[model samples]
Target chain A: MLPVFDVVLAAAILVSAALALWVRDRIAAVSGFLVTGLLVSLSWLRLGAPDVALAEAAIGAGLTGALLLRSAHRIPCAPSKALPPSLWCAAGALAIAISGAIVWTVTSFGAAPVYPSLVADNLPESGAQNPVTAVLLNFRAWDTLLEIAVLFVALTVVIMVAPARPRTAPLGPLVQPFARVLLPLTVLIGGHLLWQGGHAPGGAFQAGAVLAGGAIALGLSGVIGSKLTRQNGLALLAIAGLAIFALAALAAEVLTGALLGYPAGEAKTWIIAIESALTLSIAATLFLLFFGPAERH
Target chain B: MSELSLLVLLPFLAATLTVAVPGRAASLGLVATAANALLVVSLCREIIARGAVEQVIGGWAAPLGITFVGDGLAAVMLAMTAIVSLAITAQAMSTPGRAGFWPLWMATLGALNGLFLSGDLFNLYVAFEILGLAAVGLTALAGTPMALRAAFDYLTAGLAGSLLILLGIALSYSVTGRVDLETVVVLTESSNGRIALALIAAGLAVKAALFPLHFWMPAAHSSAVPVASALLSALVVKGALYLALRLSIEGGAGAEFLRSALAVLGTGGMLWGAWNALRAERLKLLVAHSTVAQIGLIALAIGVAGDPLQNGLWTAAALLMLSHALAKAAMFLAVGRIAEALGHDRISGLNREELRPGAAEFAFAIAAISLVGLPPTAGFIGKWILIEGLVDEGAVHWIALLLLGTALSAAYLSRVVSRCLRGGPHVSATAQRLPWRSGDVAALGLATGALLLGLAAALPLTLLEVPFA
Candidate 1:
């Protein structure tokens, strides 16, 4: 019965993904993508990775969908051109064959994972209750640092290339009032999610995405202007995480006699400090990506 | 602190300051690049004295995480990057028409640094993305219709390359269950894991503009401003090639098939690029096409298997890259001055009566000599080592092809050089005397560096043999 439920959710996700690709209307396609993300998140839940499920819901469904929708509104729709039946059939056949091969391979060769016990053994020293967060923030912090740099670079490129300001009208009156009421509540919830991430299925990324959502809503409501301008304050805010994380690691070498080794018994505090900085930076970065460069004073 | 971390951070810090400084763009650019060059010099000193520096960034342990291991190859490349960037910055400062050149250039510098020092596969991807975007931004900075079109084409190609690389990363991660370089090395020893490695190497080769994958490069590099062109041709393409070399060395047998494929494509690129360069009408276009040939030669050197004799080839390839960086930047700068004086860069139009021989023409001659692989020049030293290495390997066919490519290079470069030398028909004319002195000095300095560097090979080679890896 449980397997059937998992299959149903996976089927729904596949169907939604197909619809997202097949739809002619850009707005509808974005919505379809959102549905696909949600279904995928549910599938992750079924697989017993609730932490990933939360990340998928927040990042995949919520933030990515929002970005797609915002960008879609800016893009002029192309005239719909139907693909030839032959091409469509060929694509469908290819997809089916590939997926079938993958399924066959996985089912036949699947073995019990070897690293779970290793992760479990080292989990306590990582200063995080959640194994995935421990892996991401402690054991593999270098990847996360570089990932943050990637986001920063992407933001820079978008600012350099994209038009500074949209020519469209500001958010309508109806959306403005609602945004004001919801912004604080959203921030509160985002903070909770971030706070709970060490022990639960929420982390800095999910919290940051939620926070970016609030900021984007504010921008859309015209509370924040759409002018592509450089805000030095915001840029500094965005860089704080990287600076703090890098410095902390460097400082550890002097204090602890090993690089990236936290001072004895202070691991939790260091992790919290890094996560807090990252949360703000990640939120600011996502907001900048959506808003483009803020108008320079 | 390891030299690798400093090498990566210096440009990044410079970029941040460049953006933070509130001033005329040229002044900011000058300060940032000068500071960056100074940092590079200091790093070179460290590398020469102590060897290559390795650091696990954020103090993460390898296999489970990321690390940065700099060896002799990385130090030499970093120094080359610094020299080219400094020369290009001087050229940009002299030419004041560009508005947003400095920021984009700084970003490019930062991206190059990131690419050079990164030891992890995923970090390299991030570096690629950063470099790709910055290069595209620089391409579009010219703001001409042709430049915009070229930039868009470049952007399309770059995005496709990046997507393929990302997909490769994802697949590799799924297979190995880790994204770090050391962990991937362990996992890739198995035959089944070779497929993922091949995919990644293929993706990187496309980004590096290997032969058939180089269609977008010439157009993008040729259409940009001279300073921009110098940077793009001399530095940007090298970033991806550097990453490919790093992976090949680290990946061992898993990458053998991919490396051989690169060698074949590189050989084809060398032949095709030289053929086109020999016939190119525009001087800048000729230089741009020549970059394809040069990069191909470097890739070929890297593709050769590691052996006692082959190690010299690696050093020779490094020297080749350094020489090309200096010679190419000089060529571009000299041509920019020529175009300014003559009002156009059409190679056939140099016979007009009003054109007078000046410092620019002299600079062009010196740069051309280096490009043609003349004696005592850096290009000659590089080619000589390569030829000797090939002879040791009994690769007579490749040696023949290399000589042929050199002859073709000489043929094209001499065409431009001779035209600049010839006295055109005299006319009663008052064309403004070319502001050739400063630009000429910059070009001369670089060309001199190219020549002198060959004689001082021990310095860079010592830097390249750093024990960080």
Candidate 2:
């Protein structure tokens, strides 16, 4: 019964992915993409990777879908031109070939499955009970450090481009009450996720996405985006995560002789400190990216 | 503090500070570049003294944790990056660019350091992500419709290349249950491993702008500000080429198929880029195309150098990269100065009777000489090593290809050098000397460095002897 449900879900994913490519309307294509992300996250859950699933749903689907929806509104709502039949055929062929190659390769992999057992054995000293958290915050903190830099670079690029101020309409009367509820709910969820990261499937990214969703909604409602321009402290908040993370990593090395090496019993403290800063930074960055950095001065 | 980690992370911290305090950006950028140069020099010394230095991040052992390795190749690249970055920073200081340039440049520097030092494939991918985005921002800093279009195309191409790299890493991880560079040998044991490498090579080829996939590079390079162009053409693309080199060295005999294919593509890019460069109307465009050809030459060297562990001939590729970065950066900076003085960049407009060729033009000629493999320049020495190696291996056809590439380079570069040499008939009696600027000094210094590196080639050669950690 579960296998049948998985197959159906996979088929649904393929259908929605194809729809995203073929849809004529910008909103429709984005909606299709969002559906695909959602279904893929569900597949991850079935595979027992709730951490990946949470990230895929929140950041990959939720935040990205919001960003795309904003872009769709700004862009002219026109039907996309159809590609030539030959071009379509060529694309289909290439896609099929790539999928076939991936399938063939995955089936033949003689994977030694090294990391899971290794993470398990070392989880005690890592200061995080969750193996995923242990790996992300302690075992391989360097990659996470670089990953934050990647996010920061993306934010920098978006700020560098200095997009034209987005024109937003006034919100309806119902939005105030809606936002009042959403604002608190988002804060609650974000705090819960940040606190739960060390022991559960929630983390900085998912929490940030939830917070950004609220921020973006507020932005679209003409409530506060105007005041939070690039000149505001939002930029400082955005830089805080990377700045703190890099300093901590360097300080760890100075204190312990190993890059990103935490204190013997204080790894959880370090990880939580980093993630709390990251949650705020990521939220500010995503909010800034979705809304314009400046809104007509 | 470990210099290797500092070299990568300090730039990032500086970039953040620059963003936070925009008024102090220039000071922050200068300090960061100085610190970066010092770290690179110190790291090179450490690598020489210790035979290679490795730092285990988070104190987690390999196959679980990432490591930063300062090997012979990494040390030289870092040194080369330091040299170019300092010069570019000098130019940037002299010419105040858009508000965003400093932060973007600092981020790019950090990304390049991370790239060269990273030993984990996944970690390398993350570095590429930052590098690619920062470079795209640098390109878009020109704030023109053309620059924006070029930046978008560059971003698309970079993302496509990155996708291929990530896919290859994923497959390799599945094959070996590890993402460390050493697991490459295990991945190559099966057809799946070979395919993964092929995918990675293909992706890196795009990033390196290796032939057939190099279409997005020239426009992107030519459309940016001068320092940005120099950064993109001379340094940014080298990240991909560096990874390709690492893979070839690690893969060894197993990478033969990919190497041969790279050689064939490099041969094509050699002719193709030269052909396009000869017909280029603008000076910057010509230099950009020449980069494509020069990358082909370096790729050819990597292709022909069979086992670096045995023969160490791949050092020729490193030398070529070193020379090209210096020569190409010098050419771009010099072109920027010439364009500034003349008010235009058209090759036909180079012989302005009112203003005789000055330091900038002279710098361009010397850079072209190095690029054309003339004696007493690093380019010539690099080619000499590559040619002598081929001869030792009895690979005469490879020798023929190098000579052909050499002649083509001289032909296209002479198009500008000959124009710059116009003096007796073309110059007016009242021709004025160009005013001194920091750009001229930077260009001349880098050009002279390329020229003298021929005599000093042994310095880098000695550095390149340090083994991988």
Candidate 3:
């Protein structure tokens, strides 16, 4: 039987998704997207995947929403361009129909999963108590490594094409003091999350995201200033995760004769070391992505 | 690291270094390109000696981890990428442009290498993202409004395509319980699997810029700077088509429908692209349109080839891709020099009587000959093999279409070829000065390679014989 809360959350998610897609005002659309992301996080929680739920709330809802809102504010809000209403309605109908078909297909075709048993079997050797963390950092480290490469590529592309960020005006006195108090606490929590990731639900990605949020908050309020955020040190930090990860892979291969093969009996040490570096890099990359390339000034 | 991993990692490492260090990008990129070419040779040699090499990343086997496969087909594609990239790198170094080109170019190379070698569906999608974003960055490097606009459109198309591909992978995983190529045969047994395969094929078609879906291609291809245009036309689009070929190989019986549809669309693209090329006002626009037609021909070959069991047909397709890459890169580089000399790229203005066509124009003519499948060129050998294979299959109508397409290519290319050879009334009696640059040398060398490949047809064909099955 379907749970009542699940049904309500799903419906709310759908409504917010529709609002995000159809709203004429850019700001309203962005808000809708944020709401949808938050609702999706709730759904993830209901599905009993707290790790995914936290990630959804932080990265998907928090970071993405902030990015969208900032961009929307930067671009002048013109009246939404209109297509023929009939055409719009047809597209809308088609989208709805396709989505309905997809949901129906998924619900109707339930199959047994193979990963759980395999993961359970390999859990002890994976160096992390949490299956998700183990899978992310040990069993499938190559994916994690390449995923960082994807982020690096994004940063490279943005650096090549994106215009310089417009000069930000100072926010009110409240924002500065709020950021000062919030910043240290955010860092502390982020570090805790990073530490907890080995045997629990929190990891580098979530921790980095939270840390990045704090950094962005400080930057946004003009308390830290763009110059500090955009320094050469920051640039190096932005790429540190990818570089370190790649080097570690090569180092592992050199020592073990297999690509990304961690040395025997030292998995936990290596995983932790890699995660620490990744945490820094991911935070820097996320911050850079939000703020654009570092300026010399 | 094994040579297989190095083939991808070296370029990635180069990309990082090239981006991290400024003003040194040119030399670093060149060294990387040269190193990469050597790596490809070693890889090809290894493949030739051994049947195929496969590696599981992080010491983890498939169904749970990614794999890299270096088969004959992949090696051939990698070789082509390396060659074209080498020429582009040489051209980029000699020509003055934005500092952003080297890192992006290297990243694209890394992505292309990854795409070719990746043995799983999900990894290929990641490679596609890198390729797509890097290509878009290259497009916008022109820094012109039109270029930026075209990049925007290309981005939209690419993202839509990526989403479709991701959805297809998800659906296929749901149906077949796995995401690797071996599971694709299993996917053919069910309706859901077929739909998933279809979605993947459709997405790849968009990226490959196949007909009807190719609306954004010409503008994006033409508006980029010369090296960017060459890479986009010669390598980026081919990456998508390569994945499609891989799909067809794995799809087994289910791919039959997709192949037939491809053939039909390919024929349409050939005729339509030719018509547009004939009418195109600018030289670069004509070249871009010709890419559309050439791609169509290659797609048609793949479609007609049908099953992977027919090695000859697939080889023909691969050869055509190789020949086209060489000829097209040469043509674009030559066009860059020609446009620079002529002060414009308008086809109508190409017959400047005040000036004699320079070595670049001569390079264009040679490249054009290859494009038209004239004698003593790689294009001719590729086409000859394709025609022979088609004839063996007793597909007469396809033969007629192929011949007609050939004639159409010749006719359109003659527009530039004739203009370059004969000076009109406006030709100045005083000899025009056209100093030879390294860029021209690189273009001519590539054109020469296209011509030489005809004489050395055994090389790539032998390399391509790594046994697909």
Candidate 4:
């Protein structure tokens, strides 16, 4: 049963990915891409990486699809041009070479480490029960800090370009009921994910993406769309995660000589506090991006 | 917090603050920049006293934790970055550019600092992402349609590079179950590890704009506002080159293939970039192209360094990078002032008879001297060490290539210097020096720093002798 499911899943992912590139219609292309992301996330789950799977589904598929859909109509599709025969041949050759090299390298590795040693041994003092959470918020929290900075950079760029306020037409009456039902469910699920992250697969990124999804849904129904411009409050919300993380890093360093090191047993408290702030910031950033361009005031 | 961490965090905090209060972005940016400069000074003194220092985040040792290493190499980069940022920030203060410039630039500084100090492979990728996105934002800050389109291309290229780097990290992890600097030594033991290094090198080449992969760079660098151009051309590209250098130092004998490939690509980029600059019609494009050529020269230096763990030749590459950052930023700022005064940046229009050589013109001339590796300048000291090393290695062919590249650089940069020397025909005997604006002063100050750095080259050379622990 597992073997059969894997084959079908792999085939579906390839088909959707091909369609994502081949489709001429923007909406269809984005949908195809989103489907591919979802399938890939399922594959990650099959590989026993539920944390990665959750992130891939939420941010990689859901948020990216919404972003593309928002900009679909504004960006006029260019006429497709076929490449010359020689160029096509070159591209094909290059592709084959790269694939061959990668396969050779992968096969030589024998087996993936899955989770390298030392991680499990050091887990007890990591402040989080879940290995993924421990790695992200403790062991290599510096990478997470830089990752937060990366998100803010994206937000700042979007604002710099200040794409038009995007006259997104309010959705039909059916959307109102959908949002009413989804919004409350979103808050519950997001809160649950944030709280469960210390010992489970749910975390700030997934929770934030889920919350952003609800916000986008409500905005589409004209519930709070126009009011959520790139105002001061929204800007504060967007930057809060990175600012909080950086300040926490400094505070941690002051308390302990090592950056991001919590005092012995207080790791969970710091992780939860930081993740809570990150969820709000991440949600705000995704929501702002979906609404299209922080219009220049 | 360790100075290494503070070097990164302070700018980040300022970036967040700047975004929060756009009206006070300039003052906040300057203050943060000054503090960052002081931090670099502190870090450098520590590195000089202590061979190299390592900070393990959260007190988690490597293989699981992220570490920041402040060796002589990282110190040199931090110091150059700090000094150059000071001038760039002062210029940005007076320029009053796009509202996002201050915040974007602050993030960029933090990212560069992080990129230089990161000892973990995955953390380097994260730093690269932050630097890449922030750079693209700076390029798009010009707000022109062309700038926006260029920024889109840059974003595409940068994301591709990041993906390649991530793939490399994943592959390396799969092979060795590790992603710290120590993995560089372990990666050399197996073919799969070699492939991982190649993949990472390929990504860095794209980010560094080495020769064939530099398609997105010229347009993006040439079209941005002056301060943005200075930061992008002088510093952002260095993040990738610095990583390549770090790999060579850590990988040692096992990474010969990557080093040689870098040298070959560096040679190609040097000539290709020079050839393009000689042909470029705009001043900014010429300066931007010069950056590509200079980066190639540094890459070539890295290629010939032969196991940096045993020899100090790679310090030549580091010196070249330091000299290039200062000189290139000065050139861009001076170019900005000249363009402002002339109302256009056309190379042909630079020799305005109505104007005599001003402070900006003099600054450009000094910067050009440094670029061409002339005497009494930082660039000359770098080239000196580079050539001396090449001679000792008895690589006659490499020496010829170096000379040719040097000549090519001089020929192209002279295109602007000659124009700046506009004299005889134009009746401007009574013309006073053009009033120095904030931009001109910044340019001249940076140019002089580069010029005087040659005399102080011993300091960085000694610092480079400090071994990484």
Candidate 5:
């Protein structure tokens, strides 16, 4: 039964992904992608990676879908002109060859779990029961910090390059009521996810993305209109995470005698504190990425 | 303090500050870049003062946790990135239509810093995405039809490259069960895992604009605004090349085959790029194509791994990258000024009849000399080390190719230099006053640094003796 479920989910994922790529209509393709993300999340759950499944659901299905939908609405959904027969044939052949190569390569990969013993040995010292969190927060904290930076940078680029222009029309009626109901619940859920990251299947990134989703919902609903002017306070709020993290690391050097080295026994507390700060920052950064630069009223 | 964490965080803090300080965009941007530069300099000093700085993020040690390791290689790259970024920021501030350039530029700076410092596979992917998006935005900031078209093509290419990289990362993670660089390095001892590493390298090479994968580069770089072109050509592409180098160093014997493949591609790129650059009709396009050739040279140097004689080759590549960054940025800025004065950038159609010998023209000559690997310049030093290494390795073919590439570069660059030098009786009367002394000084300073860096190579080379050595 388990094997059957895996097969079914895998099949669904493949079909949806293919449709997402092949569909001509931008909106339809985006919906196909959303479905594909859902299937991928399901597959992650079936594989016993609930944390990854959570991330897939929030980031893959939720945030990415929203982004695609917004972009699709912003840009006209024009289809490309048909390619000549020879070019079409060549493209098809190339696609088939690539698919074949990918399949062959994936099937040929030998099973190897070299890091299991290492992860198990270090799991205790990592101050987290969940290996994923241990890996994400402790073992690979540099990556996470930089990933936060990536989000921050992306937001900055979006704001700087695509400055918020004045919108002619206000939000439709449906969006305001929807946002009013959804925003608080989203904030609550996001807080829970962030707080639960150490022991369970939620973390700063997933939580932050969720928080951004709520903020975006509010912004789109005209509760927060696109103002043409920049907000200094919001800008400062956006960078709070990075500044806090760097300061914490600097403090760590003074307290623990190494950069980013937490106090030995109080590792969990420090990790949580850092994670909490990161969560707020991540949320703000993601919100900025979505809303762009806040325009003046 | 771990050199790695500092390397990543410094630019990030700057990026955040740049966006946060809303009213004074230019000053905020400058402060961010300047702060990052100071951090990079300090990091370099630390590496030189100590050995390589290694930190497992969150106090988690390697193989189980993510690690940030900074060696001589990373330090040099970071320093170079800081320098180029500072110069570009200075230039961008004075350029027209620079209202939105600072924030995106800062973001790009942060992403580049992250790319250089990251020691995990997934983290590297995230950085690549950030860099790719920022670069695309920067490309589009020129706000011309040509710039938009070029940016769109660049965006598509960048996305495709990123997807390939993502696929490679997923495959590697599946095989190794960990995303940490050290863990993957340990796992690559087997032949079965080697293939996954190769896929990752190929994806990286595509983004690095090596040879056949560089189809989107010249158009994207040449068509954008001058500062944008400089950043894209000199620094943005180097992020991927730096990754390729890091992977080759960490992957051990599993990467040998991949390195050979890179050598082939690099040679192809060098020859092809040089040939195209020579035949190119536009001055900016010529410089852009020359960048392809220069990047190819660096890749080739990196690919000639595992030989005892070439143990110091990475330093040579680093120096080459630095020289290229400075010279290229200066060239682009000079071209911007020249184009502004002459009202066009077409090579053959440059109004030599009306041209005057000024700061822009002088800066162009200096940049051209450095670019063509002339004496006393950093470019010459880089070429010298490469040629010396090639001779020691008995790689006559590579040496010949290098010499040929250098000659072609000189020929193409000299065309612009000579054109600017043509101050005959019929000089143009409509030349506008060059608006920003700071811009010219920045270009001149960088061009001078390119030359001065060669004489002071010992300082940076001393820092290269980290884990790799």
Candidate 6:
């Protein structure tokens, strides 16, 4: 029964991915993308990677789908030019060859769990019960720090480009009431995610996205102001993650003897502090990316 | 702080600070770049005295956490980056940029530092991501319709390149269970490993704007502001090319096939870029195209010096990169000053007597001489070493191609040089006074450095003796 479900879900995923690529209408293509995202998240769930499944569902499926839908509304859908038959045939063949090589390589990988056992061994001192969180926030915090910097750079680029300001028009009276209820719930869940990150699947990214979702809701309903403009404070908030993370990493180096090293046994406290700041910074940056430079009233 | 970490962190912190406080961004940029240059100088000194400097981030060792390694090659490249960045930063200071430019430039500096120092494949990918986005943003800062469109193409190309690199990393991890640079030897033992490496090489080639994969480079680099173009043409592209060289050296057996292929592609890029540059009407476009030609030359050097054990040949390649970075950066900054005074960069219009060519023209002449590999410049020394190596190996065909590339560089550069010196009819009664700004001084300083580097060839040669890996 489990195998059957897996096969069906995989098939659905493939179909939706193809649909996303081949669909002519923008709306339909986006719907296809959303479906594929959901199915992919479901596949993650079936693989027993609940953390990945949650991320895929929240950020990958939900936020990405929303962004796509919004973009689709702005751009007119046109029929994409079909490639020449010879080109298509060549591409197909190349894809097959590459896929075959990949499959062969994966199957022949030696019977070791690779980094997992090593990660487990070092997990205790890494300050988080959850290995993934430990890796992200402590062990390999440099990558995470740079990752947020990537986000911050993207935000900076978008602000520099200054695209058309997004409308803050309410979705009518219905959205106000809906947002009023949803906003509080989002904050609670987001905070919970941040706190739970030490021992579970939740972390700064997931929590930040949830908070951004709430901000987006308020933005859509004409509450908390609309049309994200470049405010000095907002800009500060946006870069807060990079600033705080760098300072923390440097301070750690000074206090301890190594870059990004935590003080003995007090790792959890530092990680949480960094995460909370990152949560706010990420939320602001992503929210601003979704919203254009705030409209001057 | 460990010098290795400071190499990446200092610029990153400065970039954030620049973003936070944009009021004195240009000045702050100058100060930061100066400090960063000093740091790089110290790093190079340390690498020369010692062997290499390695630091583990977050107290986690390799295969679990990233490491920063600064070796002879990394030191040379960092020094090159430092020189170019400082010159460009000084030029930018004289002519203030848009509010967004300083931070993006600083971020790019940080990213380049990270790229050169990163000892792990995945960490390099993150660095590439930051580098790519910041570079694209810088390209679009010109704010022209053409600039924006080109930036979009660059963004797409960069993303595709990064995806290929990421795919290669994934494959590598699955096979060797390590994304560290040290795993390259183990990676060469299998066909899958070879393919993975090829993918990585291809991705880096795209980012470096090697021929055929470089459709977005000319327009993007040519259309950007002068300071931005100087950085983009000189330092940003080298970041990727540096990676390609590192991979070939570390990749052991797997690199043999790729090296020959790179040589073929590189030779093609050399001639093709020269052809385009010779035909380019706009001065900036000509400079940008010349970059493609120069990159081809460096890539050819890397391809030829595929074996790390061939110390002299490999060191020659590093020297070539060093020479190109300095000369090309000086050329771009000179072009920027010219464009500013003339109010246009049309190559044909460069002869106007009303807009008399001053110190900027002198700088352009010197940079052009270096680019053409004339005597008493770093370019000549580098090319001479490369040709000598080719002679020893009896690779006469490559020798001929290298000479032909030199002649073509001379020919194309002379087009701009002669035009700058030509006398044109005084069209406007109101003489557009080409006041000497500090930007010209920066250009002259860089050009002088390139010339001095040729005379001081022993310095870099000594630094390059420390074997990579």
Candidate achieving higher TM-score, 3 or 4: 4
Tens-digit lDDT track for model 3 on B111-142? 89989998888888888988998899899889
Q: After superposition, how far is residue B82 of candidate 1 from its true place, in Å?
A: 1.9
**iRMSD for every model:** 3.6, 1.0, 1.8, 1.8, 2.9, 1.4
Candidate 2 similarity to native, TM-score: 0.97
Candidate 5 wrong stretches, greater than 4 Å: A77-79, A84-111, A114-128, A163-180, A219-235, A293-297, B1-4, B28-50, B93-97, B182-191, B251-254, B304-315, B353-355, B424-430, B465-469
Question: Which pairs, if any, clash in model 6?
Answer: A228-A293, A228-A294, A229-A293, A229-A294
For each candidate, what's the DockQ?
0.31, 0.81, 0.54, 0.70, 0.45, 0.68
TM-scores, all models, native as reference: 0.88, 0.97, 0.96, 0.97, 0.89, 0.97
After superposing candidate 2 on the true structure, give the runs of residues whose Cα lies further than 4 Å from its correct spot.
Answer: A76-90, A295-297, B423-434
Model 1 agreement with the true structure over B97-199: per-residue lDDT tens digits:
4544665687688778767877777777877877887788788877778988898888888888877677667656656666666645654565435545665
Which clashing pairs does model 3 show?
Answer: B353-B426, B353-B427, B353-B428, B354-B427, B354-B428
Q: Candidate 6, after superposition: displacement of residue B107 in Å?
A: 0.6
Which is the leading candidate under lDDT?
A: 4
Please give, for residues A43-147, the per-residue lDDT of candidate 2 as tens digits: 999999998999999889988898888778767755558899999999999989988988888788468878989998999899888888888888988888888
Stretches off by above 4 angstroms in model 6 are A76-82, A109-113, A227-230, A295-297, B426-431
Candidate 5 chain B: 10-residue stretch with minimal lDDT: B423-432
Clashes of each: 6, 0, 5, 0, 10, 4
lDDT of 4 by residue, B1-469 (tens): 6787788999999999998888889999999999999999888898898689988888988867878888888999999899999999989887766778888999999999998888999999999999999999989988899899999999999999989999898889878877888888888878888899899999999999998899999999998989999999899999999999999989988889989998999999999999999999999999889888998999998998889888778888998898899999999999888777766787876665656778888999998888888888878888788788878989889889989999999999999899877744432233344465677888999999988889999998988889887
lDDT of 2 at B253: 75
Rank by lDDT, descending?
4, 2, 6, 3, 5, 1
State candidate 3's TM-score.
Answer: 0.96
Model 3 chain B weakest 10-residue run by lDDT: B425-434
- Residue-wise lDDT of candidate 3 within A218-294, one digit each (tens)? 99899878787557688678777777887888888898887877888888999999999998988988888888864
A1-297: candidate 5 lDDT, tens digit per residue: 989888988998999999999998889999999999999998988889998998889887998898788678678756678789999999999889867766665677545655678778877777677788877766666566666665665665566555455563657888788888998899899889987888889988788888878887787777866551255555566678777777777677678766666778776888888888887777777666666655521
Name the TM-score of candidate 5: 0.89
What's the iRMSD of model 1?
A: 3.6
Candidates sorted by DockQ, best first: 2, 4, 6, 3, 5, 1
Candidate 5, B374: how far from true, in Å?
Answer: 2.5
Model 6, B1-469: lDDT tens digits are 8777777787878888888888978778888898889998888888888788888888889888888888888888888988888888878888866867988998899899989998999989999999999999999998889999999999999999999999888888878888889877677778778778888888998999999798989999999988889889989999899998888788755677877877888888999999999999999999999999999988888888757654467677788888888888888888987776777778877887656678888888998888888888888888888888888889999989999999999999999999988999643344365777778888998888988899998888888787664
